[model samples]
Target: MRLSNKRKAPLYNFINTALIMFLVMGILAFFAEEMRFQLLGMEAYLFIAVPAMLIIIFYLNGRQIFEYDSDGEALHFRNRNIVPFMSTPLSDEFPKYKFVKFETFTFLFFKRLYITINSKSGNTILKYEISYLTWKELNDLKFSLNKVIKNNKEKVNDE
Candidate 1:
């Protein structure tokens, strides 16, 4: 099975632009108010708080394109940010039997997948951003990963 979220990456540009536009509008509106001191309620709060909160939340999301391929004899994983400069890309390929385990976790809006793989030196864990995947895609990924783990167990038994 193969899973990819590359198609959805283009939407980030629109989202980023919209967020910036909202922040700019908020700042402009706040300054445009003639009586800055008179503002002392939700109206004043919304102008600054909302935009700042948006930026902070967006930064925490770390929206990265994720690709996973389990074809032939190896499993492939690729993770890269659509923003380019945010982080270095992670590309890995290893044998099916070497896949030790896989886990997932979410913090606030941040979601990630951690894959543990076996090696001669030690077991290494890989992290992938899964914040942008749809429900179907996430399920497919879980299924694929479980299948690999099952296969790995079988191979161990045979050995």
Candidate 2:
């Protein structure tokens, strides 16, 4: 099964980013004035430069587009611009058990699924922001991931 990117709540990312940026800007405004008043000139610039750089980076690369090909056991994520240099693929062996976890709030407005792959080398986690997925797609992803993980584990055990 192939799961293409779903676009829902397009402004969700923008809202989150704006909220965090606003908080940082507010802090800088409050603190910078206080520091200048107190004769701490250099410290004021540090506070502005550091977080401003971080916010710029976050706005540029924080949101990604995810593409999943379950039949091929490949998952790919890339920056919004779809640049090949920014693409990341998470494809390989599956974890032993409980490789997927579903998280939802009580109100159920937000949902996320995390798929964790563990190997001899390290662990990688792929997150599915289900708020952007259809109900059928979300269920299929959970089922397909579990099925693949179970099959991989059994094959390893047999050997």
Candidate 3:
């Protein structure tokens, strides 16, 4: 099975970048203001510059790539239009374990979606807030993953 999405970068990358940029800029602005007050009589807001740059970089160059190929036994992910962020092996054991439950919750004032996957091995959770993804894409991913769990359970039962 081959599943792919040609969407923009993942929302997580944007959020992470924004947050880090905010902090860095905040500090820089504080120092800039302090220096100006001490050395010169002019007041300046240098902190805003860093965050502005971050926003531009994120919007212009940010890209996300999601691909899952069951036949090839790989799941590939790329973020920020840079090197691949994740390349996980598609374990054959996935199909044998039953899906205990799966849930999605809204966070950050409902600006993001947090998906929690629970199986026999435990729980794996991922959060996304990008507007580019559709419900169908999310559902299809879940369905494909469930196949692995089902197969694992069947094998156990047969044994």
Best by TM-score: 1
Model 3 lDDT at residue 143: 80
* Candidate ordering by TM-score (highest first): 1, 2, 3
Candidates ranked by lDDT: 1, 2, 3
Q: Rate the local accuracy (lDDT) of all candidates.
A: 0.83, 0.53, 0.49
lDDT, candidate 1, residue 99?
A: 92
- Higher-TM-score candidate among 2 and 3? 2
lDDT of 1 by residue, 1-159 (tens): 888888877687777778888999987777766356555455765887798898778767765688999989999999887777877888999988889898989776688999999888899998888887877898899999998889878877999
Q: What's the lDDT for candidate 1?
A: 0.83
Per-residue CA lDDT of candidate 3, range 33-121, in tens? 77665553333444655666665654443234445454543333222232345333222223223333344443332223333445556
Q: For candidate 2, what's the RMSD?
A: 8.5
Q: Cα RMSDs of all predictions? A: 2.4, 8.5, 8.1
The top-ranked prediction according to lDDT is 1
TM-scores, all candidates, are 0.85, 0.44, 0.39
Tens digit of lDDT per residue, candidate 2, span 1-159?
666553532454575467577668857775867856667655666656766666555444323344556554444432232233543533333424534333332124445556565646676665544445557866776676667667777876999
